[model samples]
Target: MGRAGHRTALMVAACAALLLAGCTGAQGTNGPELTNTSPVPVSPGSEADPTSSPSSGESDEDGDDEAGDDAPEPSASATETESGPAFPADTKPDTAEPTGEGETFLSVTDVRVAAHDGYDRVVFDLDGTGSGKPGWRVEYVDQATDDGSGDAVRVDGDAILRVSLSGTAIPTDSGVEEFSGDRIEPADTESIDEIVYRYWFEGYTTAFIGVDDAERPFRVFLLEDPMRVVVDVRH
Candidate 1:
């Protein structure tokens, strides 16, 4: 062969070799071929089963129901707890019932008025057991009668008053004399004519009298618990 023809043939052989090398490089760079071992089984009617799987934002509603069942019940109020056996709200209790009893019980048992020496002597009987202490007052009342003509023997605002005490077993004259003022004297000596009124303490009982005038329409109350006497003078 001539030199030019031989060179051209050699160039064609080199070109064919280069083309084969490029094809092999492309196959190697594309990565490995995969093989299938088993087929993935598809479930039938899975979409129709409500409990099969939870959706993206869903939670178990049964947990919420259990929490509601476990919650504690509410408590009652204090008013409801104290509701039974109470006194009626609007009623006032009666005050005349005997708060204390016995011979020495110094409750005001009775009262009477008598005219003596131009003075009205209002007497009281202390029926309870008490030694009448100093905190006693002789209040008086004065009002004209309906006729308004004759002088009504109403309890004068200014009246002489005295207090004494007696029982089946009489209290001492000295005890009765102790309560009288300089102007007033004991009613001319006697045993308890009536239960004028009685008030008692640890070792003493007292009866009361008006040296002057006691306000009329009078009521007497003995507060024995605290040892007090309230003489109400009404018109």
Candidate 2:
């Protein structure tokens, strides 16, 4: 062969050897060879999918951001409402004597009436420079009469209950303001019809409680710490 042809043949032989070396390396490997492939980076010790749900530790950390997640809800009926006293069976009258001194200088300051579930309550609040508590005399009467003028007072209802407060004094003597309101007719009461208050006369404060039909069971008691007289009448 000529010199140029010999040189061309050598170049062709070298190129065939390089091609065979590359194809042998690729075919001899355990896995198929890939072209222009990029390897994905993974964390050091992680086993879960990256695009899937978070791990347990990561989920708990997210839950910490939300407050009161595991706390119990408050109950709707945790507190109970208070109820009034029961109705009395006795129909007799009640009375109590004064405490401390013979003639207390107490003056009637206010009068309040409220109805309960089974009875009606009337409170006579007293305040003054008295030495002790006040006394009371309560009973059923055929007619209500005024102590100052011996004249009969017109009262409503079929039965009349006379409430006489002893050891009382006039507004001038007690150094306290007397109740200025006249009649009180409670709308929520079941038995009591009306209350007519008379002025204090001669160390006694007299009042009339008009009741429905016949006389019912009644109870009278006195209390201290801003003195008061309480009357409970059954329906």
Candidate 3:
């Protein structure tokens, strides 16, 4: 062969060997191989959808805020109202106390009269050794009368309220009159005019309450602790 031809053939052989070496690695792979272990970073515009639903933890916080804004306040309706007690108006009512049906010594201590919104109240305080209330019957009479002799007792106002108590007497077992105050208590106010102290005889006593109204409705009741009889007259 000629010299130039020989040189051209050698160059072509060397180029082919280099190409074959590049095609295989040390483990004898067929083509170029990649062992990329690092993760590829994404661009800003290629991030997740901006309008998508949030994660569970973030979603719960957002939902709570929305629900709180929509929550309702307490109701002020009248249907959910408080209840109260009912009391009687005028006329005779059930006996308020156990003031009668027993035999015991009762003495008068003090008498007080006061005017109220719906009625005029008269309180008769009784002092006794035993634990018993004085039984009384209060009725409207033309005139009050003195005990035993039945003499007419003059009291102020047009109507007289006779109070006859059963379970008590003025003088105790020691024969001492516990009450020394005046029998006629002047109360020139409201329906009541005067309070009269009647006589005590045979384990019994009588008194009078003078009110201005003749046809007024009245209620009688008894109190404890200090034992007193209360008369309420509707104005």
Candidate 4:
């Protein structure tokens, strides 16, 4: 071979070697290695950093929360109750009647009580004439007392109804022996807690009617012929 041919061959060999070395520095189909220096683009939906938190996205409707779908719903409001009995509610006191006032003395013979619909009745029967209107005062109070001695009468119930009859007395050998029985009687009555025969003092006899409740309604009236004082108390 000639010297010119050998020099040309040597230049061509050096050019080929330089081209191969340049191609080796760039990435190829074999993918990037640890030593790669090119900027790596972040792909969509791909995790940028292996140790970083995940991104927040729109959740599906069927997914459950930490409390879960088994949690109960909040409750509603409460309810009320029914009302009370329906009846007349009069509690006024009355003076004596003009029809039956002819006897010298009005004798209290019996004190009776009976239960009725929505009310309890107290009947005071006198053995003498009731021409004079028997004056009476009846009202509920916090305390009960004796009409003569002024001692506190221990009444059992929510309230004590004081019944004062102005023109009745009992005839007894021992200074008018009052009617004999329990001064306080509720053994057979409904709304009445007791029927206490208090005392007869100065032509005025006072008794106590113990009731079951405080807000009950009551009324007072008089009956003819037999001379009876009628007291009606609501349940």
Query: Which of candidates 2 and 3 is the stronger one according to TM-score?
Result: 2
> Can you tell me which runs of candidate 2 are displaced by over 4 Å?
1-89
Q: List the residue pairs that clash in candidate 4.
A: 96-133, 96-134, 97-133, 100-130, 100-131, 101-130, 101-131, 101-132
Backbone clash numbers for all candidates listed: 33, 0, 2, 8
lDDT of 2 by residue, 71-182 (tens): 7876542111122234357655667777766446898998888886677778888998857889899988989999967899988888998999988888887899999978
Model 4 stretches with alpha carbons more than 4 Å out: 1-103, 170-178
Candidate 3: stretches off by over 4 Å: 1-103, 174-177, 183-188
lDDT of 3: 0.64
All candidates in order of lDDT, best leading: 2, 4, 3, 1
Judge candidate 4 against the unseen true structure and give its global Cα lDDT, from 0 to 1: 0.66
Task: Please state the error at residue 102 of candidate 1 in Å.
Answer: 9.4
* Highest-scoring model, lDDT: 2
Q: What TM-score does model 4 achieve against the real structure?
A: 0.54
Best by TM-score: 2
Q: What is the C-alpha RMSD of each candidate to the true structure, in Å?
A: 24.2, 12.3, 15.6, 22.3
Superposed Cα deviation of residue 151, candidate 1 (Å): 27
Residue 147 local lDDT, model 2: 95
TM-score of each: 0.20, 0.61, 0.54, 0.54
